[model samples]
Target: MIEPTAEPAVEARGLTKRFGSKLAVGGLDLRIEKGTVFGFIGPNGAGKSTTIRMLMGLLPMNGGDATVMGIDVRQRPEAVRRCVGYVPEQHLIYRWMRVKEVLWFCRQLHEAWNESLARELCQQFELSGQTKVRHLSKGMLAKLALIIALAPEPELLILDEPMAGLDPIIREEFLETVLQSFCRGGRTIFFSTHMLGDIQRLADSVGIIHDGRLLVHGSVADLLSRTKRVRLALERDELPAELPQGVIRTWRNRRECVLTITDCDSQKVQHLEDAAQVRVVEVLDVGLEDIFKDYIKGQREAI
Candidate 1:
């Protein structure tokens, strides 16, 4: 288990936001420790972006509070911005300016901008300083946005779907760059995305949100360990009218039944077998993607 430290890099308590009668985010409580790569995942319009914007002080909350790098977002938003780097889904840079000019302009805005780091990143990304932003490809544009965020050298980096539209190769490169360059010296990352592969690869911890509510938050290993797929072969070619406890979802045909379950253990499995009156054929590990799908599906069914 990953132990949390006393002080968290980011913390939110009862964070709430609303658009007219629509509640975008509701009572979201979260904590991300320093140096941890935390993935915030949800489907589209699941309040992932709304929560992030509130945390970044770019959006006003209807209720509750948040702190980024130990600075209160409501009271000291500018201070929080200074201590955190943010990369929104859209790259809103000046397309008319050259890459070097863009860097220069942004440098003047930030007190702790690292020119050396920015130059190094430009070289690594093969971004020519003289090239205009409009001339850069989608991949290059994405790299530039990342470069701008990292060059600030903030304690916390908040990314809102940073890899949303990139091709497979560029996405791989982006993840690798983040892993190698930014995940050092105890810098924290709060990454928001619907990509299960990215979360599995990059995040130490994960939080899943659905309909403005956080469904689960924990270490990746712990979640995977506790969630499993149990295959059962029944003597009778029929399933029980009611599912066993802890089973989130189930699929069956004839004598075969596959169960998706949570909080799984030897005792739980034994109970399930006894309760369902079925013979256990195999207990299989569940992947992050399947787990995510099950969670979302379960929530949708409940609604």
Candidate 2:
């Protein structure tokens, strides 16, 4: 077993997973530093869940290697689990148990469980001890899961689409909770979600995956700064089959060509417009989601 490192909270090298003939995650690699909030963003069936499961050791990988909290995931799965807190997309507690009963069960299993922190998170998450798991609303169930994940005070938090089915209000609350915890100190967060808005809200760094492959991965600031959505007004009734370098996606509609590009700025936009013989009508700043969408669109059209 590898000793826990003070630097990398999570690391993967050529991590691979498969189910039957389908490659769910393929040759995936990522490095999440300690105390960083790393968001994994992708559409459904993009291998995000499969990758998270691999990290949690809930599903075995077919190839490659991974580590969490510096413990080799495949070699010492139990040690890796000890230092990671996991929140899955769906509720998993027994329906018959009361909220507090589940907590008691978890506390018994984890010798390192901090009771004070557990109590604190229970209050913050507004979970009631007396309420049966069966009677909890979807939002309440989500909150309960968060409290359980937090109570352990694990060094790394692994969340798998925890906010997937939540309403905007609840999602906002969840984001707030995550942000508060992140600001507290020295904890690493690795989460996968289709909710790009949540990624923008909670992540310092992000990785984008699609069809068992990584599309982009880097600091959120760097990604947003490099990507842009540009709108061009075509003076001539012609559409070029190819656009200038860095244009990830371009499509003509009526008299305009809308495009998204990476490694672009104002000067580059001007140059592109001149080269393409189009007027630069608008150049818009984009978030992580827009960049991901543009890439996916480009990939689809290419195929």
* TM-score for each candidate, following the candidate numbering: 0.92, 0.89
Residue 271 of model 2: what lDDT? Answer: 72
Q: State the TM-score for model 1.
A: 0.92
Relative to the true structure, how large is the alpha-carbon lDDT of every model? 0.87, 0.83
lDDT tens per residue, model 2, 1-303? 123356598889999998999999999989888878899988788998889888888889999999888788998888887778899877798899998999999888786888898787778777889999999999889888887888778888888888878898888888888778777888889988887777777788899888899888888888898898888887776654456578878777877888888788777676765655675568889877678888888878878
lDDT of 2: 0.83
lDDT of 1 by residue, 31-107 (tens): 99888899999999999999998998989999999988888999998888887888888899999999999999999
- What clash count goes with each model? 0, 0
Deviation from native of the Cα of residue 242 in model 1, angstroms: 6.9
Give RMSD to native, each candidate.
Answer: 2.2, 3.6
Which clashing pairs does model 1 show? Answer: none
